[model samples]
Target chain A: MHSALRFIALDWGSTRLRAYCCELTPQQELVLLAQASGPGVVKIVGTFSDVLQQVIAPFVKQYGELPIFMAGQISSSIGWFETPYLNCPVTPQAILHSVCERISGQQSLYIMSGLRYQNPSGDNDTMRGEELQLLGLLRRYPQYLHGQHLVCLPGTHCKWVLLDNGYVSWFKSAITGELFDVLLQHSILLPKPATLYTDDWATFTAGCQRALTFPNESIVHALFSVRTKQLFDAYTASNARSYLSGLLIGADVGSILHDTKVESLPTGSIILIGSGALQQAYATALTQANQQSVLITEQEVVLAGFAAVANQTLLPLSCQA
Target chain B: MHSALRFIALDWGSTRLRAYCCELTPQQELVLLAQASGPGVVKIVGTFSDVLQQVIAPFVKQYGELPIFMAGQISSSIGWFETPYLNCPVTPQAILHSVCERISGQQSLYIMSGLRYQNPSGDNDTMRGEELQLLGLLRRYPQYLHGQHLVCLPGTHCKWVLLDNGYVSWFKSAITGELFDVLLQHSILLPKPATLYTDDWATFTAGCQRALTFPNESIVHALFSVRTKQLFDAYTASNARSYLSGLLIGADVGSILHDTKVESLPTGSIILIGSGALQQAYATALTQANQQSVLITEQEVVLAGFAAVANQTLLPLSCQA
Candidate 1:
């Protein structure tokens, strides 16, 4: 039996650290061998190195001294080590070339730097973790390589990336998920229900439709409708949760597609990278907005991106490498 | 010496109660004799009647069994006594006719029912205390009765009412202030500054200008720019608060003005009923939106409204007939 090619990959974000032990298969796919997760960057009580060492202890014990790679906010300013943001119009190769390397005792570690875009008016926006997901998407399906495409990775900060000729041409970030969370917890509208509403597509679609139909700058007014709808008995408190989600997601999608810089892009076949419920919601919203979208699991994209960067570390060293 | 005409008027709302003791002069002007304030309906630990009695004890002693008038959320379902909503398109006379009365021993109390608007599509929105403010505006300045005037009362629930043909033809509420509060307290953006920035009109107006220029539903997108702006050092933590405020307020004004129904209304000289810092902020936003506005103090409006409603109670009534 051919010994499995092994490596350790971490998807470390603001609030959680997910460690993955993976093996490269003969079919050129990265397969997860074992996985563990601990507190994210914010929750770590001790130095990041200490917590990281503890998290990967099992993986290292099982497979001695495997090369490890970290992505996302772990490489951000608040992370274990600060990796500078790479200016956008970056290709997958450029992203790979920007990885920062460090030695922690016996461990070899690589971290992917985030992407920053300076707008025409000189405003800067940065994205660190999502770049790995984008790189993974491009590598997994090279078909998206040749043309301009919209890639939306929905999370706390939903990223709307324009992939022009296989490079991150420009992107915008929407605080959709974070806003939703804050509103649900702190705002008067949509108080947490006695029991979570599992699936309420009717109100969700209605919310999505409202966002799509309303004039683009009227979101503040539209949001108040969530409360009025509940007060009028049009929606129960339970279902209002889904409605709130839909309104936020729908607004994000609507604004992203309607943005002037993005209006020129091809309308159909946007790639949506999200997981579970968020994925379903965005897909439903995209459909309601009359846009075609290709759904890709966030897990697969993250892993593929992590594996690509890990595999790069194994390449033969050159004098100018 | 002639004894001053005496009555008790309370502007009782969700969080606080402002009670005013006023006398009607021989000149037919209502003058402020004395005033006091205490816990509003939501904060009252004991029965509202008990609280009211305590609040007006000195007034009752000075003038025996004075008629009391209350307006705002204190008359709503959650307040001392539940008063049903009076439908809009209501005149000052209609508002006076809708006051619900109660008697505690020798003390007689009158509470104004809030205004409720049911859209053609059957959504119900109710406004309590603001009706008094709107009424105060009309009674205070009868000239506004002649034509369509946009009366914007900026506060926790900002009310944008159309005073058409001497009546409240229609109105809409935007959760601008409440949203701003929740966002400041709960969201990652705009953490409360250790020291207030005091004034940041440059960034504030930039935010307002952004709202005016962007499409109406793009507010969700513009809001995120608050964070990105800070991330890039474009704004300090202190100034960002104003920017966030501008974004919300500007979006509100933009959407209210841009709505198809009110788009036909004359745009100049909006009646902006607010007080203090909020009034200044809304005025700034309105100017950026290319509209002229006249500022009216909320204190005068609420007090005048209470006095107006109280005047109605005295007419056609005699000690024994």
Candidate 2:
């Protein structure tokens, strides 16, 4: 049961595989000295042994198999193996066992379960990457999110999860991103520029403000105004910013904040994940809506989550027990 | 002047232009005789005279003047003549008029003014084409739209206009289309290969219904489920219908139906102007939304609108007295 054993963490996804080598020094502190990423879980198939060998190549030389664990889509049915999800309201034991078969003579491999949420609406739903991010968010802002907190992780399918007293009570996901894409390009709005250029917080915040203020006209008028402005005023492709920000945030607020008392949500903050324009857009939305804010990095949380599972699955028998 | 004179109406904008010619049947009712279109006013500027001659070749032979009138962006500053916009709450007298002589005294032209909507939100917005379409929508459903009515014209910029009696009282527009475009394509769920296939009004209505019931999550999570169903369960591209249906309608309900009595608006139900997919998307939304609906053709409204203006402007004294 060496607490000092180097703990290896992996953040594997559709595109790339990244790993970090971490260990506790004598003062009992975790240090990450090396990290690397390669062509990810999507490229590999039933050849889990070969895929993993390539994935862990960077860290294998430094730490052997002192202790390791993984996260991301790498554990999905299509990735290394079908790691059945743990129905959440999960504890340590609620975690799913990995379906990985080991090398001829090697340390055991354990994969954490992804989370599935039954929409009370009778829709089947689950999330693998974000719940780990939520877990990481809670660890970072434990005191701030003491009661019921709603975190918005914006992306392809933007997720809004409810964290009641640090245990996920209910959560929902929306495909704001996907809907936006099909509508803009394929719909009548094309023949205009392919993209808007105002990639700043002001654009996003103004959009969020519009969303909170007028849920209905917010998106529609916002778009029409872009054409109107371009035709009538000094509008660049940038005017699309306020409209874009308004649609995503406004739609989120519309979908998530129904019958919700603005004053009552736990510490009243929305956490936004992802990076570049998206993070800023969420930040803009939160500030405009006067809701509190927290940002958990998309990459870091996945990394920490892998480490969290590693600490739980591959550490000492006593530590894991 | 012969009130029996054959007439032609044109609506031109940045991307496209269209014209409709109507002859007074022996019965004295306007009947469509011929129609044509090309790259709108912006592109056909230099050849305006030649195109005008070719367009009205039939009418010119029948009547010497061949008086023609245009509307929408044709009257905008970018229009061939730069006819300016009139203030809101205006009358026919207030219309900014521009006259042009094309093809060396070959044809006489008049362009119409666009409407300006100045509301409390400081939205001094304007519309070129749809107002005429709404006028035609009213022409058809005079019983429903004659009184106070809320008109929902969906497109890149969806419009929510309040009409007092027959005149437009005030209106607002949003970029629901652009948001839907960017979000769907560029965001995470872009994997679904189906292009803008028709919407599954059932799923879309469910989404719309979900929006009215739980407005908060309508925008974000509403989209992803479609993709998941497609990816995991082999949901057809048609299944993306619910996504589009939900998105277009869900966003409409979520963004527009705020603290106001979203359940009910003015009695006219929703009057949709855009055609094909956009129109169907709105009809599905209005159905789920429990709103009566009417759709006006893109071609007819713009043409009828030009006729409406021609009725007022070309021979103002004959009708005014």
Candidate 3:
């Protein structure tokens, strides 16, 4: 195997595509060399291949014939190719083994399969990209393999995955981020904050407290309160954003705790795999709920998962299953 | 007093203004003579007088000095002239007593004051136009004067008002319509339904059922499932809109039933003051929850309320208080 640069790690999402030039070390470590991002699946309304070619042109010029390993929305129905979602409870191997491959000239592109989780209630939920991140986290840290651990991957469709002894036991998705985005752009109730205004964390925490303190009125009525608070001068335009964020995150966490099938899941601190402001908001919200969380950088886990797929480390688990 | 026509009854809200030329009968009952509507307070960024003059031009020509009784957002800060909000638990008399008036030519325009409700939890909520509608309904139906009745004015901002002995005891607002509107226009998850397609009431009832059945995952997560159902072919693009509407309305009703202070409040059938399809949707949702409801036209209540204000019939209650 060529050791210097073996694979291209790509996290193609609905609205954006992120790529990283990666190498495999002698000690079986994935090293990220160069990174690039551009228009996501949503932007490429025409041909996915053409957009992919344009987006990864720089990486291809630097390292030729390096097979691309991809995950996320790129593998779903709307992406470059449609791959079947593997049903849970699935191990890392089940994910790696289900990769669908396509060839562009001499380059080999492998897309990781998505996951379909059926909760105890028999309702099914799907995730495309975050599954790979979970696999990568498991490969890097095997401590989570013994006991049942829960991970909250917060985003546009935040995923709450329950990992039990190296298997994805069950998962649920919260549409908080997407709802928040639409509300921010469209709702007449919430005023548009100034460009220079930073998030008011105190207001956010207060919102989180409200969510925890008042569970019944948390989702529906509390959202309206964002507007009422602004109208009543209790919250300024700048602080409304943070307050909205806190309310959403707090409600999601509260739902996961109260509503889900596995309410009594023996997980201590939730493993939150996300980055930037959104993740921090969730972490703060969890803290307000008296719940502890450990944050993991999204990119690191995604790249590692792609590396794990490339090296076929997950094959043995699938074979065992 | 002139018996033929006394005043123009204006129900000015955030997005639209509905006006009715009303007359006081020999028995002191209100009779709506003619009606007109135009862009609401939100659309009138210019001088409200210009828009008002344009809309009621025909009425103005006929009834030269007939007074105009206005209620709703017209009396808000952003409306023609701001009126102070009356404190709850308040009778229709208090609302009438707080009317702010302005003289346009020989015409006296009276704008009804809003209502402010502060709960035991110390959270404050306000209502403008719905308060007038409630007062109008109370004037028309005196049965509510002796018992605790619940009135739901379903609209962009759905007002769930609790009326106890002719006073607005406690009320809550849900931004369901506004959320649904934004999601329809802005969110990528839901595909636009066919314009010519009629509403699938069965699918809507199914959505309501889902909301009632899945109480835990109903509000936040169920919204996202509208997208997944379409993606997985569980629901088509045509039915997605109805399903989304059901989910929103169902969750809203569920939230009201579960979370509010009047969770234990006993009432046979809710008094739903609304019109058209939105009212039908709420009624269907309420029926799904095994709750009965009585429908009342919003216009009748508003006009009656305005006439009551103009004739000073509500003064007796204020004097008694």
Candidate 4:
């Protein structure tokens, strides 16, 4: 039987810290054992070593001197050490150099490198923890990404990446969800529903279509139509929520997808990495914009991604040789 | 001089107020005398009579038992009382009924009626003070309204109205200026400019074009480009300001006039209202959207509108009969 071995991985983001313990069976099935998390490395102010020691103390107490892998903002400019942003066209070796080094530790540790790419416009894009998930998803479903694929990782600034040949070729970020919050709460035409998202969400979906179809239509006007329609007794406040939702989603999709050659992207084949409201909103937009669909949850992808990075750490001959 | 004018017509809106003192000179100029505004009728709160008593007391003291002509939100539902929304396809008589009979003490008051029209799809539209202004502008520049004239009233919600046959037909409002404020301040794009609008604001005008030309582009993506462009040394703060300005104004124009086929409204002619910032912004949009242009300030046209409404209050014997 192949050696029953354990692996551990850590993900530290702008606002989170997580550590997990896992093992690969002789049959190569990955199983999670224990996991722990604390406030992110960036959020806590202290010596980098102290942060690392404090966070790992719980796991260390149970499993002494374990192999561990780390990724995320802990490797950013203000984190443990300034791991300078890796420029485009970086290799695995170059990426290794981009990881944080020099920590006085008693056990084994491997740091994952962020991915970077240069666009034809000489622009650059990079990612760390989430990129690992893409690799894992690709490894598991290789054929799904062989052709140019559109992968959307939705969040604060939702990143939409186009993967060509297993590498991130180009990507754009849209603050669609963020803007929705502002427009809904802060803007003048805030159509705050007396109620939350209701059953008649189709009105919102239709508003999205209006926005998408007519990129130049006055969203303000469309927005006030929610009020006037309600006032004039043609629409209800319940409908207001959907109208506002549709307007925002429609506007976002219309504006973003307008420049793209819409026919080129295969419908219903999108890869989405998001959770909660953002995922649903993006899915709605994708359905509207491409008449196709993409729905990939961030939680699932993030865990799988952490595992994939851990899988790389097992090849010690490459990193420590 | 004859009776030295027993009354003045006060037309108050989002910005300034116009008081058309109704008296006669050898050459009738409907002399517009004094104007002092603490707050508009829509802005002040209290009993309708108290607000009117306090606001008009000063003006009433100056002109004594002066007949007053009122309109706009003064007749709105939340105002003194419910001057029910007459809706669109409204006639001059419908407006008189929409006004409160006792708007100003015992003095007879007549509030001008706004224009309301329902589109073929049953979509409704209305305008407040602009109708009177259009009435006056047409009275003065009749030909201007007949041959495809587009009048723009810049405010919190900018209105673009198309006038023909001495009637205010259809209008659309754009929240361009307000969007600029939110996008510039609250958005993740950039902090508000250290200063107010610059004297040379070509950048803002250019922004309008971008909005008009690329209405369907993801505003969030467009926003990121602003920062990235700034970071990569491609855009200066001025350019950033310009891009934002262009974006909003462009969006306004794009929303109002993109491929929209109405029955031949002249592109070059535009009427602008509001104070300086709005004036400049309107000028910029007109220049870009029309390629050829002329801007008629609200000051010039609004007074004419006030005068027109004042003259109409006399009521020809033919109508009374």
In candidate 2 chain B, what residue range of length 10 has the lowest lDDT sum?
B92-101
- Per-residue lDDT tens digits for candidate 4, residues A11-96, read 77645777777675656567777787866653577676777677777767877666777777566544564444555433323443
Candidate 2, residue B251: the lDDT equals: 61
DockQ of 2: 0.30
lDDT measured at residue B16 in model 3 versus the true structure, 0 to 100: 86
Which scores greater on lDDT, model 2 or model 3?
Answer: 3
Give residue A269's error in model 1 in angstroms. Answer: 0.8
Q: What is each predicted model's overall lDDT from 0 to 1?
A: 0.80, 0.59, 0.79, 0.59
Q: For residues B1-321, what per-residue lDDT tens digits would candidate 3 score against the true structure?
A: 333436788888877889788777757877777789899876675688888888888887887656777888788756778888888999877876777777876666777888888878666788888887887888888888878887889887889988888888899988888888788777766653434546778778877788878676636677767777776656765587888888889988987878546677885799998999899999999988888999999877877778778778333433465
For model 3, how does the per-residue alpha-carbon lDDT over A1-321 read when each residue is reduced to its tens digit?
333336778899877789888887757777787888877776675687777777778877988756788888888766777788899999988887888787866666888889997656556788999999998898778798778888999877888888989899888888888888788867766754434557899888877888777766637677877876776756877688788878888888877788545578764999999999888999988888788999999987887788878777433433565
Clashing pairs in 3: B16-B40
Residue pairs whose backbone atoms clash in candidate 1:
A16-A40, A216-B216, A216-B217, A216-B218, A217-B215, A217-B216, A217-B217, A217-B218, A218-B216, A218-B217
Q: Which candidate has the highest TM-score of all? A: 3
The TM-scores of all predictions, comma-separated, are 0.89, 0.71, 0.90, 0.74
Write one digit per residue (lDDT tens) for candidate 2, span B1-321: 345545777766545667777664434356677777766654564676677667667655665555676766666654565655555654323342323333337456666656777666554678665566666555545664446666677754567766666666676666566466554554444343547665565666655666556554444555566545654556566665556556556666555656253335544455666778778777776666666777766766555555555555555544565
> What docking class should model 2 receive?
acceptable
Q: Which residue window of length 10 is worst by lDDT in model 3 chain A? A: A312-321
Write candidate 1's Cα lDDT for A1-321 as tens digits. Answer: 233468888999866788999987646678898999998765689888898889999988898778788898788655788888888889899887778888877667888899999888776778879999988998888988888899989877788899998999999888888788778876656644445666688888877888887744376667767777786666877678788888888889888777888778766698999889889999999888888889999989899898787666654332125
Total clashing pairs in model 1: 10
